[model samples]
Target: MCYVMSYIRMAMCVILFLTLFTGMCVADSKGNLALNGMAVQSSLGHPQGDAQNAVDGNRDSDYKKESCTFTKTEFNPWWRVDLGNVYTVSNVTITNRGDCCKERLRGAQIRIGNKLDNNGNNNELAATILTAPNGTQTFSFESVNGRYVNIFLPGNDEILTLCEVEVFAEKKLLINI
Candidate 1:
C-alpha cells in the first residue's frame, strides 16, 4: 500500500495538530508561575500606544501639582488598572484607545484587592462593570473576583480610548508553547 498510506496520513496530521493547537494547554495559571509566588510587579498601568498618555487626572487647579499634561476633562482619564498578581480575575476587556473616542466618557470603575483576607475581612469591592448604558465598555468578570483592577474612565472631558486589554483566568491553560 502506498507506504502504509503515507504513514497513516502523516500520523493523522500529527494528531490534528496536537489537539487543535494544544487544545488550550492545561496546567494552571495559563503559563505557569508558581515558583513560590510573590514577585510580580508589572508596571501595572496604562500609557501604552497612547490613550492620551493613559492619564494625568485631576491636574493642578489647586490640587497642588500632580497631573501635568493630558488632562482634557469630561471625566478624567482613568485607567489605574493594577492587577499584577494574585490571580482569579474572571474577565476584563477594554478597547479603542489612543486619540481617545472624542472625550465625554462617563462611567467606568473597578477597584480590587482591598487586602485584609487571611481572616482579616475587608477585601470586598467585587463587581461593578458600570451597570448599563455604558456600551463600548467591555467587561465579563463572571464571578466578580478581584485583585486590583481599577478602570474608571467616565466622561473625563471627552478623552477615552483602549486597544485590547483582556485579562481572564478561571482555569485551563498551563503552557501552550
Candidate 2:
C-alpha cells in the first residue's frame, strides 16, 4: 500500500508540472493576434508605392518592381497603420526591401499609441532599429495598448520603403474563476 501511494504521488507531480508548463507555452502563442488587412498610410504619395501595399500580405521586398511602398526622400519620412480598434500590441514585424538600398531603413523609430496627432509621431515610442536590415525583422517590446502604429525615419535624404508590416497583439481572454 505504501508503494502504491508513492506511485500516485509521483504521477501527480508529473501531471502538475506538465499542466503548468503547457499553460506557459500557450500564453505566448495567444499574444500574436493577426492585424492583417488593416489600413496603411505614408507621408509620401507614390502612385505605385502606395502605403496599402505594405499590408497586402505580400513581402516581395522589391521596391523597383513596385512590390513595396516608398516615400520621397525627405526629413522625418514616416509610415503608419491603423488597427481599426485599440489593441494590446506585442510586437511589430517589418519586411525591408531586399533588392537594394536596405540601409535606408536605419534609425527608424517605431511609435505606437491611439493618438493621431502630428502624423502619429506623437505616439509612444516602442522601439528603434539601429541597423537597417535587408530582410524581415521582428521588433518586440513590452506590450502596449494602441490603435495606431507608426514608423518614422528621422533626418533628411531618407526614404521609407517597406515590403510588409505585421502587427501582433494580445487577444483578450475571459476566464471565470
How many residue pairs clash in all the candidates, one count each?
A: 21, 0
Model 2 lDDT on a 0 to 1 scale: 0.78
**Pairs clashing in candidate 2?**
none
lDDT digits (tens) for residues 35-143 of candidate 1: 1222111122333323222232221221113221222344334443334455566655443232324233335454445353321123444444443322234456454
lDDT of 2 by residue, 1-177 (tens): 999999999999886776666432122335333335555555554788888778877778987777688898787888888776567787899999998889988999999888989889889999999999869999999987777889888898789888888888776421111
Alpha-carbon RMSD of each model: 15.1, 8.6
Off by over 4 Å in 2: 1-42, 173-177
Error of 2 at 35 (Å): 5.0
The TM-score leader among the candidates is 2
Best by lDDT: 2
lDDT of all the models against the reference?
0.40, 0.78
